[model samples]
Target: MDDDRTRGAGERIADARKARSLSQRQLAENSHVSLSLLRKVEQGSRDATPALVAAVARALTIDVTALTGQPYDLGGRHLDPLHQHIPKLRRALTYWDLPPDGITPRPSAELVRGAEHAADLRRSGNHAQLAALLPALLTETTAAIHTAPAGREREHAYATLTVLLFAAHSVTYKTGYIDLSTLIEERTHWAALASSDPVLGALAAWARTTSLLQAGSYNIGLQLLDRAQADIPTGREPGESVLRMSGALHLRAAMLAARSGDSDLAHDHLGSARRLSTQLGDVDHDGGRYQLAFGPANTGVHVVAAAVELGDGDEAINQASQVRITSDLPKIRACHHYIDLARAYLWTGAKEESLRCLTTAREIAPQQTRHHPTTREVVRMLIRLHHRSNTQLTRMAGWIGHDA
Candidate 1:
C-alpha cells in the first residue's frame, strides 16, 4: 500500500510538471532542488519527505495536498494578501530608514533576481508571499537604482522600481508604507533622464496617479491625471487596439472621483473615458493595463459602489444586479458585488432580501473580512440598522466573528 501510494504521488507530481510545461531540470532549477532528487522523486525511486513535498509544492505554485490528491481546507487561513506581510514590511522599512552605515548593500545580481522572483510570485497570485518579500525587494531595488551606472542599466533599475511600486499598490490601498509623494518625486527625477521617451513618462504618470487615487487624495489624483492626459502628444497614433493614455487616465480619474463623493465630476470623467474607449476599440495603447475600460463586470460594480456612497441605493442595486460574475475573475470582486447588493437592499428597507444577498456574498467569499474592505463596512451598517430596529443580525455578524 505504501509503495503504491508513493508511486502515485510521484506520478502526480510528474504529470503536474508536464501539464505546466516544465521540464524536470527546469523544475529542479526553479525549485532550488537538485536535478538528481527531482528525477528520483519523479521516477518513484525516492520517497518525498515533508520538506521535499513542500519544496515541490512551492515550485509548482500549489499546496502539498494538491500534489498528493488529498483534500486540504484553507478555511482558517487569512486570505488578505497584505495582512501578514504588511507588518513585516513596516518593520523592514523602519530598519532601512536607520543610519546610512547600518545597512549593507546586497549583490546586484541577487537584487535583480529577487525582484524578478517577486514579479513571478505576483503573477502566480501568491500575493501573500510577494507582500512578505516586497520590503527587502524594494530596498534592494532602491539600492540598485542609486548605484547603477548611467544609461540602460539605470533605466532598467528605474523600470523595476516602478513595477514594484505598482505591485505593492495592487495589494493594499493607502497603506502608509508605500510613499506616494516620494514616488511622484522620484518620477520627476527620472523623467529628466528619459525626456525623449514619452512612454516612460506616461508609465510614471500612471503610477503616480494610481497611488494618489488609492491613497484617497482625489484632488491631487485628478490634477496629476489631467496633466498626463493633456501632455499626450497629438498625431502620434499608437498602433492598433489601444486606448489613448488620455482616456485611460480619465477612466481612473472618474473612478477616483466617484469614490470620493464627486458624482458630477465622476460622470464627466467616465463619459470621456467611455467615448475614448469606444474610439480606441479594445486595449489601452500606452500601457495596456486594461483591455476594455467598461466591459468587465468590475466597471459596473464600481459605478454601483459610487452610487451607493452617494445615497442612491435604488440606482446602486439596479446597477449591481446587472454585473455578471465569472469564474475567471478574481473572487474578491464577486464578493464586493454581493456585498454591495446587500447594502443596497438594506438601505431600501428590504431586510429579508438584504440578508439573502449577504449570505450569498459570504459563501462566495468566505474569508470576506480579510479580502474585502467593503465587506466589513457593510456588515457594520447592517448591524447598526438591526440594532436600531431592535432586531438581530446574528448571521451576518457571525460571518465575520462579530456579535450583534
Candidate 2:
C-alpha cells in the first residue's frame, strides 16, 4: 500500500488494461477518452482528470478508488490520528439500530451543541479533530435519540444525529474509507427520514451525490437532486435553509451535468445556484448550521469546478479569477477551490501557478491536501514537466507518495 501511494492512476489503468487483455486504443475507445490523452496519462506525462478517471474506471470495470489509489497509506504521519478513529466509527455505525449498552446520553440540548461543534470541525477541515470527536458523539447521539420521548425531543435528536453523521461522513469519505462513508450515508438518510424534516432529507440527497459522481452515474445523480429539491415544500416563502439546500443541489447537479457532457445544462444549473446564493445574501454557512453550505463563494467555486469537469480550463481560470473567497467561507471549501484552480492552471500550461495553488491549498488544510487525489495528480504533473528538480516539488511529491 505504501508503494501504491507512489503509483499514479495511469499506471494502475495500464495494469488493469493488461489484465483485461486490452490495448490502449481499445481502452480509449471504450472509455470515450482521446487516445493521445490516454497515452500521455499512461506514459506519465499527463494528469488524470476526475471525469477521465471515472470514465476509464467504468470502462475497466473497476472502482474509481482502484485507479486513484485512495485511502493512501501515509506511513505514520501526524495525520495518523485520523485513521485511529475509523474502527470506532465503524462500530458506532454498525450499532446504529441498537445504541451501545451502558451509556447514558447527556441532555438533548447538550447533544445538539456537540453535534454543532462536530459540524464546525468538519467545515473547518480539521479532520483529526473531527475524527476525535465523532465516536463519542455518535454514541451519545444515538443513545439520546433512543431514550428521548416520542415527540419533538426525539425528532430533534434524530436531526442532530443526522448532522453528526454528515460530519462523520466528511472525515470517512475524505480519508478514503469509502465503505464506511457509504454506511454513514445510509445512517444519515435513515436519521433524516426519521426526523421527518424535509430539509435534512434534501441534505442527505446532496451528500449521496458524491458517490454517484464517483460511479459516473450522472443522469441518475441529476434526477436525485431534482427529486430532493421537489420534496422540500415552498408553499410559503422558501426559508434560508430550504433555499440554500436548493442551491447546493443545483451546484451538485452542475457538476454532474458537466461530467455528463451536458455543457448547457451545467451552465444552467450554475446560473440557478448563483441566483439562489444572491438571494441568500452572504451565506457564510455559519458553522454549517443548515448542514449544507451555499453562498456566493461556494457558487463561484462550483462554477470553476464545472468548467474544469467540462474540460474548459480557460473558463475555469476566468471564473476563478473573478470570484473572491471571503473570510467566512469554510477552510475545506476554500482548500477545494484551490485544488480545482491548481488543476485548471495545469490544463492551461501555467505550471508554476498551479504549484502555487497546491501550496496554498496545503496551507489552508494540510490533512486534506495530503490526502486529496487531485493534489497528487497535480504534483505528478508538475514533476513530469520539470526539467530540473524543484525542492518544493520534490518535497511535496514525497509527502504525497510520489517519487520526485
Candidate 3:
C-alpha cells in the first residue's frame, strides 16, 4: 500500500480493535504480534511491512485487503468487487469534514454507491458479507466524526454511526447474539455525541429503545422512550415527527407486558399509544419510517397481539383482521403485522390461516421471522398446534415451555 493508505489502514485497524474492547496487548496476543510492535504501528510511529500487515489481518480474521484496499488474491478471494470503492468513501468523508446536515450535498457519488451496496447487501440477506465490511465503515465514519470541522459535520458522523449500529444489530440478531445490551450502550454513547441535534438524538434514542424492547426489557425500554419523548422539541414542524417513537415504545411495551402475562400494564401502554396517535392528528405515514411507529393498522395489530396474549382470541382475530398491511409504506412494518396476525389466528384456532400467514411472513422477510421474538414464538406455537414430534419443536418447546 502507499504510505498514506498504509497509515489510514493502521489507524482503522487500531480503531476496530478498540471498538471490540481489545487492548493493544490483547490484540497482539490474538494477532500473534508483539505488544510493542502493535502499539508502535497503531500510533503510526512504525511502518507495517506487508508481511506484518498480513499477519495482523489473519489474526483479526479479516482480509488483508480489507485493511489496505490492496488487490490481493489470497488463497481465499472472497472480498467482493464492491470492496474496491471503500477508499473513495474514506476520501469523501474526509473531504466533507463530517457535516451534520445529513451528508452535505447528499454524499459523494462513491459514498452513495457504497451506501447503496450496503443497503443491497442488507436486503439480499448477505448479513455476513455486510458484517465483514462494517469494521472499516465504522472506523472511517468515526474518524470523520472526530475530525469533523463543524457541528453540522459532527451530526453527519452521528448519522453514519446510527446506520452502522443498525447494520451491526442486523448481523448480531441473525447470528442469535440477541443480548443487545452492549449495542444499546454503544448507541447511548453515540447519542451523547449527537445530543445537540434533537432529531438525531431522538433517532439514537429510538434505536436504543427498540433494541431493549426486542430483548424483552419492556420496563427499561419504556423508561428510555419516556426520556426521549421529554427531549423532543415542542411546536416543531409537523414534518419533524416523533409520532413513531411515541407509538413504538408504547406498542412494544404493551406487547411485552401482554406476552409476559401482565394484562393491566399492556392495556395501559396500548391506551397511551392510542391516545398519542389521536393527539398527533392525521397520520403522517412518511414520519413512520424513522421509528416504524404503530399507525392505524399497526395500532390495531398490537391490540390484537396483546389481546391474544391475554387469552382473548376472538378479540385478537377480530382486531388483527381489521388491519390492512398493503399500505404504500415499506414492507417491514407489514412483516410485523402479518407475524402478529399469524399469532392471533393460531390462538383463535384458525390453524390453516396462521400457517399461511407464517409462510407469507417468511417469504417477505425470513430474517424477521427467524430473529424476532414475537415471530419465533408464533412459529413455535404453530409447531405445537400441529402436534409435531420433532427435534426442532422439541428444542423450541424447551425455549418457550416456561412461557406456556
Candidate 4:
C-alpha cells in the first residue's frame, strides 16, 4: 500500500491547522472538540465523525468538503461511472429557463411516467441509471413546461419537472457534487413553487435544510423546518401528503438537533415523527408521491441515524435491532441503515461485525457505498485496527480509492 498517499480527513485537518499556524490545543479549543480526540484524529489513530469534522471545519472557516475531500475522484476503475454524467446534468440544470431548440417533449402522461420511473431508480439506489436519465429528462421536461398551455397543462408540466429535478438533486448530492446539488435544489424550489403544490414546496424546504445541517447551523435549520411545517396545514384531519412531508421535516429536524448536542430536542422530534408515521400507516411505495419516504420503517431508520449523530452507539444498535427493514424500503435508506450499524458496531468495539455491516451495505448499493464519506472513514478505522493484512477489507478499502 502507498502509505504516503493514503491521506484521510484527519491528515487534511492537521495540515489545515498547521497552515493556519494554530497548535493542536488551539484548534481543539476553537472547535470545541476534546484535545485528546483531536490529537488521535490528527495522528490517524481514530476516525473523524461528521460532527467532529463539521465543528473543525467551522473553526477553520473552511467548507466541510475541504476536510472530507468530497467529489473524491480517484480516477480509478473502482470509482462509480456516474461521475461522467455530472457535466451534462449541470448543463441541463443550467438551461432550465431555456428549452433546447427543436426538442419536443412527449405527451403529458408519458412524461409523468418517465418522471415516476426516475423516482423509482432513485429509491431503488440505481443511481448510475438515474444519472444517465437526468439530462434528457430535464431538457424534455423543460420543453414541456415551456410549450404547455398557461393553465392546468403548464402546472402539470411544472409538477412533473419538480419531481424529476428532485431526483436529479438526489443523484448529484450523493455523488458529492455539492455545488451542483445546491443549484439543483434552487431549481427544485423554483419548480416546486411553480407547480402550485404546497407539499412540493415544503419538500424543497426540507431538502434545503441539508445545507444548513452541514454548515452546523442547527438553530437556523430548525427554524426553517418550523416554517415549512407551518406552511403545511397540520390541523385536525390533515391529508396523508401533508403528514408525510411534515413527518419528513421532523426526521430532518431530529438529525439537526442530535448533531447540535441537544439530545432531548432530538428525541422530541423523533417522537413527533413516530406519531405522524402511525397516522399515515403502511404505504405501498417507499417514497410514494412526495419523493420522501416517511413511514414506521423510515422513521425507525431516522432514529438509528440520529442516535449515531448523538454518538450514542448503544442506543443506535438497540434501535436498529428492533427496526424491521423490509425489502420494499428504499435501497438507499436500507443501505444507510447498514452504514449506521457499521459505525455503531465499530464504536462498541465489534470490529468484525462492523466490517460485516459495511459489506452488507456494499451488496445493497455499491455505487452509494463507494461514494459515501462515512464508508471511507469506517474502512480507514478498520484498517487501523487490523494491522495484519486482510484481503477482503483491503479490497473494500481500495474500492473507495483508499489504499490500506
Local distance difference test, each candidate: 0.56, 0.86, 0.56, 0.87
Best by TM-score: 2
For model 1, residues 320-347, the per-residue Cα lDDT tens digits are 6776665543444556567777767876
Compared with the true structure, the alpha-carbon lDDT of candidate 4 equals 0.87
* Model 4 bad stretches (over 4 Å): 1-5, 282-285
Clash counts per candidate, in order, are 0, 0, 6, 0
Write the residue-wise lDDT of candidate 3 on 1-404 in tens digits. 22221133467678768777888888898866688977866765443433345566666766544554332211122233333433433333232223333332324233435544554455445544675675556555555566656676666556656555555555544433434334544653464457365655655665565445433355676677677667766565544365566666677778667755689999998898888767765453534224344456567667877886566667877776676654533345556566767766766678678767766666676545544444444544555466645454344333322122
**Candidate 1 — worst ten consecutive residues by lDDT sum?**
284-293
Which pairs clash inside model 1? Answer: none
lDDT of 1 at 316: 83
TM-score of the candidate numbered 3? 0.58
- What residue runs in model 1 are displaced by over 4 Å at the alpha carbon? 1-84, 91-127, 172-217, 232-235, 239-246, 259-261, 279-298, 326-339, 352-373, 385-401
- Give the alpha carbon lDDT tens digit for every residue of 138-223 in model 2: 99889888888998889999999999999998888898888878888888899999998998998898888888888889999999
Quote the lDDT for 60 in model 3.
73
Candidate 1 at residue 226, lDDT? Answer: 77
Q: Which scores higher on TM-score, 1 or 3? A: 3
- Give the C-alpha miss distance for residue 85 in model 2, angstroms: 1.3
lDDT tens readout by residue for model 4, 331-379: 9999999998999998998998899999999999888887788898889
Model 4, poorest ten-residue lDDT window?
Answer: 71-80
Arranged by lDDT, best first? 4, 2, 1, 3
TM-scores for every predicted model: 0.58, 0.96, 0.58, 0.96
